[model samples]
Target: MTLDTDPGVAPQEEKLEMAADLTAAKEVAATDIPPELVAQSFGGYLRAWMARIRSGDSGVLPVLLGLIGITIVFEIISPNNVFLNTGNLVNLFQQSAVFMVLGMAEIFVLLLGEIDLSVGYVGAVGGAIAIQLVQPVTINLPWWLAIAFALVVCALIGAGMGFLITRLRLPSFVVTLAGYLIFNGVLLIILLLGPFSGYPTLCTSSCSGAQNNSHIIYQLMWGTIDPTVSWIGLAVIVALFGGSMWWRDSKRRRSGLVAPPPSLTFLKIALIAVIGVVLLLICNANRGRGVVQVVGVPWVIPIVLALLVVWMVLLERTRFGRYVYAVGGNPEAARRAGVNVNRVRTLAFALCSATAGIAGLLYAANQGGLSNNVNGGQLVLYAVAAAVIGGTSLFGGRGRALHGVLGGLVIGAIYNGLYLLGLAAQYQFIATGIVLLVAVTVDALSRRGAATGARA
Candidate 1:
């Protein structure tokens, strides 16, 4: 028997009926949906998050716990507890900038399940270019131009290496290993050919006027923000970040998309605000010795944060970023989906190299010059360790720029604390290796758990 209903009669009732049907269907299919997608409130979100953790997506939890644990250990054991002292902590951030940037560079390749061993020397080469050009003697270019030039050259180097890997279909390990040898030779030649005994330095205290180029580069690693200005900047940054989070979440909810509950979003904002305030308080403290009063945040802190923000945007917000994950997770699937896998791989390598170049600049700034004495080999190993320790998967397709930053901080803390404890560099290396091994183990177990759950 067939019964027909009028299309024009009781239109509002029809919509209501349809809506109810849709809701019923959603309820029936709820198990198929991600818990996070189905959650509509803060408590539900908590439960959903817990489920995810159980499924092996721990996110940044390990990094946070490890960081806190390390800090406590070092503060208790280091000579006079200087590890947590505000002044020493600030220095730790400065020293870590290089590692952070290098780790970030490595991440571009790591996410693609590739590696770049040449980063240390590649970055050094870029740093040498910047220092060489702005020497205030021979190629006295503006600091900004010199920096741009260095970055461009570094990017090209990366692109070249990427081309060799993609077009030649050579294994990244082999290409990058060869790149390491080639770049190291290039760095030596550049340093040797230039003045300063394979070390090029920016003009010292004598820098002035146009020669301020060197001074500016130097300040990137050594300068501090004015106290009042630092406060203003922090306020601006917090407002922007909080507003963006709120807007995005609100927008998602309004559009009937998957989003965390409002309370959870607000809580996140609040937590971020608290962290910012604490950081500012630490930096604003008078860490100066005797009569000298050193207060205000170090320039490196903001610079590193800015780098983190930029890279995060690239990886999380852009289509290219999605493609990156897709390729890393499964290149064959990504290729079938119309992604330009080769192009993405090539660009990833280029970006990785450029990032390494930035780390090189940081190293140069930290050392007060570009010197052949720079330990590119050790630096590369640390960069890899930092990325892995920060919880980036060695198997690829799972990580973030923040991971690199946190890992770098962990390494820096260990390095700094070990030195303060009068432990040898070898001891620091051993500690880092152990930490990296633990991180990898955790990652492997989590992945296995996830696979088993999926099978079930």
Candidate 2:
């Protein structure tokens, strides 16, 4: 059969069109056209599509930018040059590390839509035990051994709470309440057994600013890292932050999905590096009164960063993490999906309690020692505030370890800035309360928005 073509169409043009059609067919067969090419081909027309995909997302970018803005604004306005000083800057991390741990602990129960009113006391009891185990008047165990023992004890306690809640079908509220009372008693017993030894304060003076009259546990926990941070330590942090972003983006690309722009990713890396270097430089800036220069990264800094990474990986990369979200989203559906809901919940509790124990120890260290006056209640409230203020939800199923860090940073900034401003304790407390309330309200509103979008 003779074929007649349009008079205006050349043979070359017909061949080019045929080639394009075949390429389109191949793309349809494979699916997922190269994102970069798709973007380029669509040009600005993909803006609506990109926006749709990123809708309701709560990654770290907004928080980071907001923090930068706040820091700059505060620096510009504050008198006495306190906001830009190196000492105060390093102090920010020192201040926030405890809350980071506490926030992380809360994330577990929060994810499960449960609450742990006892974590603070549980951690307090653990720290008390640690000190008692190592005090000259008590067991006199090695410091390292004491810390390990404290962690294990706390983990078991958390497990016990989980068991009580799951096996007995008791609400988390009731179980944790009983735990709070029991642990508070335990704290008293430990304190009485070994009265605040001077050794702790003496040990922590070199590490955290904690007073020596507190328990030796705190001194040992936060007192080891000097203000003089090392280049090696800074390098490790840079590597970690870089590695995380690279791996995450690579995985996303391998999964045949669009990745964030390379420029955006590199900008994140640069921001982290800048923060690390600035932190190191500030800590190393001779701000001490004595002839001896106190500089070097605090041990707590790396510890908190490490914990942040571990928790982030657990939440973002693991099947357990997805299960956590699933349980939060629809517990009944998760159960029907054959998820080991109780097991996951129990494990989460154990992890949360153990982390809290670690944080308590750090808190004690920052003080250079634990004291009978250690306000476990107030500390727990601050921790919760840090988490929510950083953007973790009180209602659950909407948080990340990074949020804890951000939230903790915000809390720390408030404390440091307010202290510099010579604000009273009452004012500080009120300000923190307000910030936390606002954060929770925002979280609830965000959840509602997500629901609305899903329905629509």
Candidate 3:
């Protein structure tokens, strides 16, 4: 082409040659870049998790350890006793059900850096409404319809509170506290009037009313699926859990993303399987009173587990969940990012109330009926304590539904153990208060340590 004699042509040829060289160099550099490292074995994954814990992201480790310690202590104190008996264990599950659900309800709001003090009373109101509707002395509505009505009422109440808090810029604490009193009053009024009027005069060890144990409510609290059914259900659940974990890790690896080692994944599945089997064995044992044998997992156990799974998916897998974490982490930034912060918060409140309504149903079932004497104030406190104890941060933005389950178990164990040891009510209160204090202190220290580490 005689480029040396043509000035423009020579320049164009040189530029093209340079561009080709640069592209080749870039390709070489890209090839030289190292792949992201991930855990290649069980030991490596364990070390990674330990490192995370040391960095103040311990997750459920503390609570789990605490649970073990509590269990051991109780076992030692009640040597060769019913404290660890199958029947007692079943009772523990039933006792913890309401707390677990309520803690879950609290987590929705807590993760958003908000609190709903009224949830306990809200639950009472919901239960009362449902019970009345289904009672023969009242409208005698269908049990399903009664449940729907109660849940709807609770949701509306929650939405109203959310509106006031969001649109009116009211403090959640103050607003919810007010709601607590109002709802409690409403519950009392409901109990005192109409079908519930006869409830005041009747009293028993388990409940206050003769008509408390309606067919559906009684079944919910005391009924059990067949042992064969329980075993089958647990197996399916375990298989699903293992499969999901394996699939998630395999997908990540295929995408060239960080993934846990296959060995570690296997270990996780094994642990879950072990726990499930242990629980199943305990529940399947015959824990009889007199000649009557009680066996199989309580219906409430499956219900709580289902709720946990649903809430976990909602918080971890969805865009809305991300928005919740974002809003709690930094409201201003989230708003700037075009997230509808108010709407998220409002929805969180509504969800919290809905969960509380479910808890209320459980509570009523547990008691054989809804009563005016329901100590909602105490229950609310327990809910907060359970959530905090389970490793949810009081500061917000970092938590999971599993936290409630763990925390509720801790509370249940404590109460169950104390009862077995013949400890007084006052001791139970003191123990719970102390545990809550310790949890909060640990949470604060961990948060501070994390902040300092980040700076370092």
Best candidate (score: TM-score): 1
Residue 98 Cα positional deviation in candidate 3, in Å, after optimal superposition: 0.9
lDDT string for model 2 (1-456, tens) is 000101111122345556777778866466554353433222232353344334443434345555676588668766876787876777777887787788888788887888888888888777777766765544677777888999999999999999888888899988988887888887777767645543333243343323223335554334434433467766876798688877886686577555544444565677778877776677667766588665666667778878888888898789988888788767888999999888888888898899899887877677655556766677678777767766677776777777778877877777777777778788778777877776777677666765665554
TM-score, one value per model: 0.91, 0.81, 0.89
What does candidate 3's lDDT look like per residue over 233-280, in tens digits? 888988998898789878976876666666666777888788889988
The local distance difference test score of each candidate is: 0.84, 0.70, 0.81
Ranking under TM-score, best-scoring first?
A: 1, 3, 2
- Compared with the true structure, the alpha-carbon lDDT of candidate 3 equals 0.81
**Candidate 1 residues 1-456, lDDT tens each?**
000101111122345556766777767454443443367866666666666667777777787789899999999998887888999989898988999899998998999999989899999999988888888767788989999999999999999999999999999988988988888888888887656788788655667786799878887888889988988987998799889879987998898777777877788788878888888899999999999999989887888889999998999889999999999999999999999999999999999999998888878888888767878888899898889888898888998888899899999988988999999989998998898888888889888977776555
How does residue 377 of candidate 3 score in lDDT? 92
RMSD of each: 8.7, 10.0, 11.3
- The global Cα lDDT (0 to 1) of model 1 is 0.84
Clashes of each: 0, 20, 0
Q: Which scores higher on lDDT, 1 or 3?
A: 1
